[model samples]
Target: MGAGMRAARHYTLALFDALAAAGYDAPERVPRLPIVNPPLWELGHVAWFGEWFVLREASGSHPGEALGNSLLARGDDWFDSNTVPHRARWTLDLPAPGALKTYCREVQDRMLDRLAREQDLDDALYPYRLALAHEDMHGEASLYTLQTLGAAPPAALAPIGQDLLPAAVTPAQSGDGTDAAAGDIAFDGGVFLLGGDQARGFVFDNERRAAPCRVAPFAIAADLVSNADYLEFMRCGGYQNARYWSEAGRAWLMGQERSAPRYWRRDGDGGGWHELRFGRRSALDPAEPVRHVSLHEAEAYCSWAGRRLPLETEWEYAAAAGRPEFRWGRLWEWSASPFLPYEGFGADRYREYSQPWFGTRQVLRGASFATPARLRSPRFRNFFTPGRDDIFSGFRTCAP
Candidate 1:
């Protein structure tokens, strides 16, 4: 098999094996979450997506065509994400875990066979590459879903080689401050190139066609906001005070009845802090960057500190400018900008990926601990609804 096919198969099997080992095979054991998909359905969807793009669509078959000949007869009906409503997925009669695993294997075998027959591996194989990337994304999603469900960390997801284990919090070095090094790194900021350059292989649809934009002189935080920093906001009643929050933010807070960051629990006297990760609870580490906060919570914290979230352009400029002091990739940092299309924006072969969520979502720059290393790039854009706090997300601030 080719390198891309091998990688796609490896990640797909790893995720499925992990889910099965964790007792996610039974439908009753899988917890229901508004933001998460059923594990069984998700597994089949990953395989279906790969087959759709690589085997069917790449072969010039139109959308929803040739379904009867699919590796799994009902694959399209069960896993076409575009047609399958999120809520309706839980109601579907999904195949058993064992049968789903077989379907995944059959799809992988056929994809590999097709890949070997193809001559062009470069630009001609774009759809195959897209399939691999799609599977890798869902692989990360599966892990986070397990986290959201409060399941134990899967053995397949255990860190390899140099990667640190999730449970092991590294001790802060001497002279290392609990908060991000205090200061604003100032930039003269003229016209800077923004968005992805196609020259850079495998640019996502949202990041296509680099364009130059004039940016005003600005300053951004040297490091992400740490748990210690946000703790002060909570103690000062940041959540209760409406002044710190936007109109939508206030509504979300009241609807959810949230007082502190998600997964956080305070001691009876309000002096101690702890956070739940996976299925285990541990004392909150003050020096660690805060995770699992919504855009609203990040904005409120910035208001309380008299700082503001950085514009998406500024975040891009800082990362691409090669400032080693500006630490990111530890968490997905929220920006002040709303998600929108760049100049001359056009959808790629995968139309559903970026065009639909253009205006309603908030833009986030940088990657998180759970993000695949290959997917982490300075130009990559990740967006989510402002109210989403289930994923690993945090924020930094800019001078007002």
Candidate 2:
């Protein structure tokens, strides 16, 4: 098989292995969450999506192609994400774990056969690349799903061929140390080139059509907000005070009955905070960037601190400038800008990907630890609703 085909197959297998290692084989043990998918269904869908995109859609097959032409007889009915309603997935009679694994292997083998016949791995094989990128995205989703389920860390995720660092420090080891000092980076605003370059290979639809945006002079935080910094906000009743939160945020906070960040618990005497990761509770690392926070929470914290969230334009500029001190990629940082289309936005083959969530979601720049290495790009735009705190998300401050 060609290199691209080989890499795609490798990542697909790795993701499947990771799922099994994370107890996906034991469906009864996994909890049902609205934000999460049933492991069996998720795996089947990945395989089906790859086949649909590369083998059927790319090849000019009929839109209403029969599933029997592929390996699985009822694959479309079970795994087509567009056709399958989110809530109806739990009610469907999905194939057994073993059957799904077989289907995955079968679909992958067929995809490889087609890829081997192709001479070009670039533009000629865009569908294969898209399929690979899609799978990589799902791999990150699996990791976060494990986190949301409070399951143990998967063996596939352990850092390999790297020197081991010391265990994460507990709150007792560092008692509310002052927020890590950060500099305000000032930019003389001007017209800046924004969005992805399509000629550069495999740009997402949302990031297409590079355009120039004029931004005003603005100053932004050099570093992400640390756990220590957020602790003060919580202690000062940031959640209780209505003035700090937006109207929508206030409603969400009350609906969820939340006072602190998700997965955080206070010690009995209120001297320290603990965070739950992969079903294990450990003391909060004061210096680590605070994560798993919603846009609302980040905004409220910024409000209390007399700072503001950076606009998407400022963020792209900072990243493009490549200033050494402006560290990112530790967590997906939230932007104040709502997720919207660029100038002359056009949908690619994957219509549902970017168009569906345009105005309703908030944009997040930078990648998180759980994000796949291949998907890590400064130009890549990730979006989520303001109320979502389950993902690996955080934010930095900008001058108000």
Candidate 3:
């Protein structure tokens, strides 16, 4: 695994422990947050999942011995992400919290020992590292769920004040010379290194060894599209206009029964929509890239503005370009590419990180405000259902 991947694994493992220690349980005495699985379920699920592919397959172990195989998979009556949905897990009468902790410890020990013994097994490193990175990413998602549910922030988590930007005036108001200036970045696109340089370290299955890709020249906004720009779309009826939305995009829009952006509320007779950030209402920060928008919303706004969202390859092309300081602090960027594996892809030390989600979901680029900075990379791939508007997501566009 690469240094970044290892850091992610350590980071994910720590967060899961923190959630459990914080006393978030299935029947959480607290409200709003998910009935987080008792520390037992989540920890085991992560460990079991790792043990199943990494050790079992690598050593030719049997499947029956796998962790949470019965509970993690969906069964006769309903769904089980093993990630959340507390009531059912609480009903299962599974292993005690202590037992589950033991399982996670065992899995971690085995994986570490195996990794150490096979330091020379250089070929396996790629897949093994991939799986760890996969688990690490999911771990980050679980944290976002905690925030959405308003679980008290973990004491160890970095403070929230840094990225929580000040609000910007609405675009209608912004034209009067009162807005953060756009950081326009120009790119002389040509043949570029499209993925990770294996020489640099571990990379995802989809982003294998970096290879050259040719592209036409394009310019990207120096930073991501911010909340202020998106609010203008809401004010201009961007979401409501079918002319600006694709058929699938429009269908999803109508179903939401939403008029303005999600989480936005009116200020008054004269005031425009203000957003609720971490529970309190805050004026929109036009300087910050918009968050909480979906692909449909992104496309609609792109159409309305006579622009288009960048493709995943285009996003990679931009991020991988020479500029060093250009990430959108965890606010995911909408991209046009569907998620898929690269040519001649193979599993690394860890398996299934990139295999399961390929082709089923759309890809977004950039880590969010919630993402660990070390995990952010131009070639990193993030996939989600197109209709998932719940993530604090946003997008930027290339000039038409």
Candidate 4:
């Protein structure tokens, strides 16, 4: 937990450094995008979160138990995400970046000191694990925020981004440079254990009630949809053709006047494609998985290709049942499933985490290239609104 927390902090700090490079010198100067938090607020909140759950709250207390003041003066008013409105983050009198860094270091040191003395395992460490996972999640969001702002990724994260660049292989090459598991992999699909349980340490609230779910025998793509494949749809007038899109998708398409994926641009005279990644423009690697596409876009592509998005159950069953052959963790693959709670779902101490967003979002399985390794899990259900293409997300297809 300590290592993970420390790593997450460093990663987040580096992302802030990237923002500094982009010339966002002050908190209010950072654009107030709905998809992101003010950098200063986010950093302070992460520290306050660990301190709130790990050090301030009494041991053996219920999540709702109100107790203790924060080390930071009026920290709750400033850093409690549940209470603080998103827009207000920019207007608030947040401490300077240097001070936030000091707070983070102090809180981390205290949290680590506390963790070192704990002897219990699994459930006992939930609060600490939650804090780590929370920070890891924000870390990924910070990277995408950089992409959103057209800022370069921090040098420390270059290796992670480089891993996604396509090798010198044909566009028809299989996902991740392997020919195996190219097309759809058929699953017999019987009763499969869906969701996480206490046995899996630090299971999220939405991932509870590990029940046996009966999934239909479905054939799902072994690889995520590649850029080359998606390009075919676009070149064939996929976006212009309403027949390939749903009513909602057509509305979104019409609103954006989108001719290609968010970052894509037509290459000069040759008429090939290139995309902007972290402010650097490069040729579109056809072999790389198409990312930053929304659920609506994925759905439209499926319609054009006579395919469908896999249900979350089908995705999980295949991921668990199919071993080395099923490749993921490159992008957060969108699932057809809505972001709903499992049976017997109960909110954890941090009630705002999952309960509020249920039924209003779509579920995305798997992690992205920007995702922290510690947070990557097939069972980790990521949710976003259907029209949100700002996130590092993609899709795989299922045979109709």
Best candidate according to lDDT: 4
Q: Residue 105 lDDT in model 3?
A: 61
Q: Can you write out model 4's per-residue Cα lDDT over 1-400, one digit (the tens) per residue?
A: 7788888888878877778778774677899889877777888888888888888863422344546777888888898877788888889988888998899999899889989988778766888998899888888888888888888888866755544421121111111212323487876667767787567588888999878788766788888999999999998999889999989898999898897899998878757989998788977889999989988899999999999999998888777663465788888999999999999998888888888999999999988888776676777899999999989999999988
User: Candidate 2 or 3, higher lDDT?
Assistant: 2
- Candidate 2 wrongly placed segments (more than 4 Å): 1-29, 58-68, 159-182
What number of clashing residue pairs does each candidate have, in the order they appear? 0, 0, 24, 0
lDDT of 2 at 324: 62
TM-scores of all models? 0.89, 0.88, 0.76, 0.92
Each candidate: RMSD: 5.5, 6.7, 7.6, 4.9
Top TM-score: which candidate number? 4
Query: For model 1, how does the per-residue alpha-carbon lDDT over 1-400 read when each residue is reduced to its tens digit?
Result: 2676677667766766666677776555666677888788888888888788777754322454533446776777788877788877877888888798888888888888888788764565777778877887787677677678766655655541122212222221111221233566777676767776667357787886677777777788988898999998998999999999999999999998999899898876878989887767767889888888999999999989999999998888777666656677777889999999998888887788888899999999887776666677777788999998887789999888
- The C-alpha lDDT values of all candidates are 0.77, 0.77, 0.62, 0.81
lDDT of 3 by residue, 221-252 (tens): 66666677777877787766789999998888
lDDT digits (tens) for residues 306-375 of candidate 2: 9999998888877666666667777889999999999889987777889989999999998887665567
Q: Per-residue error at 306 for model 2, in Å?
A: 1.0
